[model samples]
Target: MRQINGQNSTSTIKQYSSTLLLMGSMLCSTHLLATTTATAYNANNYNAIQQTMLAEFALAYADTATALHNYTVLAIKSNSTTVKQRALNVALEQHDFKAALDIATHWVVQEPSDVPALFYLAHIALQAHEYELAAESIDKILSHDPSADLEKILAGIAPESKEDQTVLVDALQNSQAKDNPSILVIIAALEAQTGQFEQALATINRALKKRPNASNFILMKANLLSALGDEEQTRKWYSKASRQHKSNLEIRLAEVKYLIKVNDSMLALEKLEKILQKWPKAEEALFIAGLTSIDLKQYERAERYLVELRNSSQYQNDAYYYLALNAERKGHYETAKAYYRLVDGSLYAVSRQNLINIYTEQQRLNDALRFLTQERVNYPQHASFLYQAQAEILKKMGNKRAAIGLLEEAIQHLSDDPELIYAEVLLLDPFVQRDRLDQLLTLLLDLEPNHPAYLNAYAYTLALQNRRLDEARDYAERALEMAPDQASIMDTLGFVAYLQNDFSTAAKVLEQAYLLNDSVSIGVRYARALYMQGDLGRFAQILKQLQQKHPNDPQLAPLNSLLIPPPMPKSS
Candidate 1:
């Protein structure tokens, strides 16, 4: 035998030691085979020794596939559990989960009470998506070791896989460990994630029975009640939880959030004030109180809470944005602009938009354009949006040609940007630039085929020209289906119907659209549809309402002719 020594041999021996640890009891047998005299080996043992030597050589050289193959053969031929375990470890180290699963299953069959083998089998089955087999292995492992970490195993499952979640739920429901409160909690969470609120409620109630004072379970129950739309029960349970867990900030804050969700902003503010009275430095309570005050239009109180939050690192940007909103609502334009400039991160885009709106409302159009131009250079990632905003400011200033020119320049830089193309399409006069409008609309659809706004614009433009009314109707219907509650899409569909002379359909759909949003354009179409359908009284009522709402709307000028009485014939 060659003497093993030196740095290289020491490294190889260390690797062999780790490999032996995987083989468990086979380590001693392997050691004895290596040490025994040559005369002691019989023919049968000689083949086993030769294969073991080959596998060890493969491992030392880092030939994982060869090692796994030889080990798997050795494991099958021998009845030694350590040999099978070694093969399983080799397969696992190689990330050969299929071979690992097969070897683990064989190992378990040989030794049913092996906890580690069962654990490995369970995880392998989960990886293979063999849920039933995984469930069986998990059950067996739990039986052998009651303290097994089931949560760690279940964590691998995705919450979005409702079908897979349901299978696991059923298996756990019938499991020997079904009464485990930890298991019940996870099951409840999974049920809630899958939108099985009623079932989740039942599961959580069971956990609450085991641990009655568990604040998390109580909160889960309340949220489940909210999900089930039982508003009264949700309120009652949240109140009960708050009363029971007086020191628990999470429970109290959850109650405040629930109040806000139910639109009880006044009560939410009151609760938040109480929370702040106890925990004076609570940043979350201060933030919520500021927003709640804003909702109630108590500007002074909102400013006080928001100013305090400006010192908080977590809520600093959010506080600045809301402070700006509060100042704007109170008509302190300069203060609002100052606050908006300090806002950044995720709120930066909205804050900049607010500043632009403030400038526009103050009739400082040039200032708005200059600010947008500077922002585009500072934040190149938002350049397309800034260009769109600049174009709108130009349009507001009665510079439509400049707006179109700016958008054309933006499109040259951002050729694939759909929003820039759509903005330019909207700016183009349909009657004058028909081909260009059609070309951009086609391109916008290619970018986002199912975009409701793009589809609606295309349908409205086609209807405006009264060409291809059927195709226009098809596009409008598709858009309406995509955004069923969007009033603008409804208006487009109604316009398409009116263009096709389906006056009755137009009158019905346009009335719904008008009721949804009484915009001037939709109101005009509804009035015309009612007029064409011979509903003269309703048509007159709609005309009167439109005139009352928008006395000087240019779109309503054409409708004045409808109200004029026709010339009477002379009597003979």
Candidate 2:
């Protein structure tokens, strides 16, 4: 059974579980016996029971089991169309595929002309692996609307096993829907999914034979060829299809995507421009054009296409995010901020981070603090992180005391929140607040000894102060085990090895860290290990590379002076 968590609302249930639904076969069999024998003859009683059950469901006071039971009784006893539909909905909501199929079959029998009922029956049958029955139901639906697109509906027949899928394909092939072009498309797609490329190509060729000029069929054939690793043939077929039908928007879009995949962005942009010129209202084309412009670093052109998408409801927020990114790239911070505020959904988190970063970059520390204060009030759930962000700005401004004070205040509200605790521990310098740093680290490690961040921070601190070399190595190793790919943690291990005079191990570990992330600190340590190992040539070369990137870097100056060679003899 598919369990939908916590949502008892009817609309929410309907939205999420709209396709390929089935009640458990065992539950349906049990209910079928009761539905046949004990039918409620009176209409008034059934109405009253349905009303009571609906009220309970609406109030969120009834469990799914109770709702299903009540609706099942109504479906079997009552002749009302509304009552039977409710039962079908309830069975789908409970993810009982068999029950849903049983109710839906009854629904279609009662209302033979109902398109939705026929489609629901087909969807349930497909899910239950009754492929012939599903084909029959789908045929009935297509009889009502011969031109209806069954591609999306047929796409839902996803079986767990390759054997089940093959059975479904065979059943669909032998059934009444064998004559349907859309059904053939789905069959071809299934064959492709199972890696039967030749079989899929044969199926689509059959489809094209029926309608030689069908652009969708041609596009499907091109896609199959592409999947079979024949890129040249795919492009050739796409070109042939485009000549056959010049104005198919889907074909044009597919061709544009192919161009982009081949790294011919300029040509893709040209095709997109033509598509936009012909179909000015195509929001999808406009959105892609904007992103393509961004990829090509044509920020001004990106703004033009993205701004056009701003009027479209589906793409507006995403367009805003891109527009903001383009403006930021152009160094228009104020415009970028405005555009970021207009962005929403998952991108909102990214926009919020960007706002803080932009404020910091512009040296507007006071403004950032003020914004963080307001954000704390408005977004209380995220207030803990806001405190850390604010403290970081204060620390960067050389106000360590103020930063520590701010974290202490945040802790009173967030008490023992792991991130806040971690941030506070980092701020406590051992030389100045040795007792406090030790206390916090001990407490944090006691709470979550396996936490990679806490372990790395603790280990790096011990290594930095050059005390307890064995303990530091242990902590660093533990952290590396937890997050082996983390470059900073790898640096901690190398730094500890250096303190213990394990120059060989230090050089190896620090070299790995440098490869992962060529940061200045890691580079300096790596160079030092090389110099100690008498690999003076590589050491000088590494320092030279770091100096080029981080010129006037104080860390590099000390390391550079250490590698000075003996003065050459004047007599020579």
Candidate 3:
């Protein structure tokens, strides 16, 4: 009794004096006993025990249970501070937590050293997420328990070893708190992890009250806002976090991700450039920013970022891959190939393929062949690579036999592939016996009758043999149906018409094909049709040009002079 017997020292004592001159008996009364349990609130039921406390106190007897009953009786009688304290205790026992919270708050404002009251109030405040109130309540108890009691209380509430976690847990339990700064800090982490950005932002704001300038919190808040689709707010938070946490790499990276995802890749690039200007080896930042620029089709800018990162062996793989793509976009084949070689992975395969394509495009067929042949040693079953290379080489060297072997092998290995089918059909042409080659064309037509390659191959072969004009015309017309724009097939169609004596149609198809690829075969066929047309002057003119093209060719020279008048014995 002596330990907690004295009047409150200052403001609390003054509050009591203003209310009433102390009743000597009330002032000197024995302190209330402590109770162990806490209150729980129910939204549907309002606690009615505050209206019955005084009556219950007088009839109480027996143990703490009876004491609790008496306290409930006293609390029910009035809204007085003493009644409020009793109601707080009874409310805690009945688990009428909200009522206990209401009473505890009232008691604390009136009297700080009401120890049981302070303890109850702090607990309620903590549960209610009123962190500052909870802390204030507990601190007051410690302040008065001058004999190291506050430390003991806090130690007991949140054991020293796991205290931070406990404090955070305690803060979390107070879901309805008016302003719980501590709870906000921890929820910031929780919400970000779960992708619950909106709730996370509000929770983190509470933490900001505790640490207004905390960089991590600011960054987290910014990221959450971004996730919530609040870009302007997100930017504001990002800027604040960057300023507050100047050395925080994560904050800067977060801002970069936001800019990239929203298609504001130009801004992302500028930010990344600034970062690289400051810290040149930020690999992840540079790589992601480069990819963003690539997505935006800003190839030149993407290349600059990639080239800067290419200096380090660690980043070399990625740097080279991105740089190769950039060079490819610019049509710099050799430059692309140089960059492609440094990369390793499945991406390396794409790089090799792209390089092969560049060689074929430049008509450096031997280079394309050698690369794929080497690749085949390691990837022997790669049908497309093997066939593309073989086809290009054969087309250049005109080695019909060797080309046939490769085409047959490609067809056998990749029977369902359209590209390989096209290459295979091309090989069937230029053979001596049209019948032996015609069998392959019929097989291809059976496989895909509408396929232009199959149509053109069969039609052109029949026309050249001059043996089946009706079948040739049907095949050529079908090929024209699919790729009316294909010059090679157009020539076949024209020649078939000419063989059928449809000279008007032959001239039209030939002229169109001539304008398309300007192939020698089409030009000669057209000149022949012109001669048969009795347009001798035009026919003569065409032969003169053809002779210039064939120059010393024996077959064309006689044919050429026979058509044109010998250039006047002009010289003299």
Which candidate number maximizes TM-score? Answer: 2
The residue pairs found clashing in candidate 2 are 22-96, 22-97, 23-96, 23-97, 23-98, 24-96
- lDDT (C-alpha) at residue 347 in model 3: 68
Q: In candidate 2, what residue range of length 10 has the lowest lDDT sum?
A: 16-25
User: At residue 70, what lDDT does model 3 achieve?
Assistant: 45
Runs off by more than 4 Å, candidate 2? 1-62, 80-82, 142-146, 154-157, 211-219, 240-247, 333-338, 341-344, 355-367, 370-386, 407-572
Model 3 Cα lDDT, one tens digit per residue, 129-151: 45666666655665565322221
Write model 1 residue lDDT over 1-572, tens digit each, in one string.
11211111111111235446445434545656677785575454556656777887888899877888888887767667556656766776677778877877887787788776676677667656676787788778767666554544544443357777787777777777788765687688888888888988999898888888766677878889988999999999989888888899999999999999989999999999999999988999999999999989999999999999898899999999999999999999999999998888899889989999899789898988888888887889989888999999899889999999999999999989999999999899889999989989999899999999999999999998889899899999999989999998889899999888999999999999999999999999999999999999999999999999999999998888988899999999
- Clashes per candidate, residues 3 or more apart or on different chains: 0, 6, 15
Model 3: lDDT to the true structure: 0.64
User: How do the candidates rank by TM-score, highest first?
Assistant: 2, 1, 3
Residue 107 in candidate 2 has what lDDT? 76
Task: Give TM per candidate.
Answer: 0.64, 0.67, 0.41
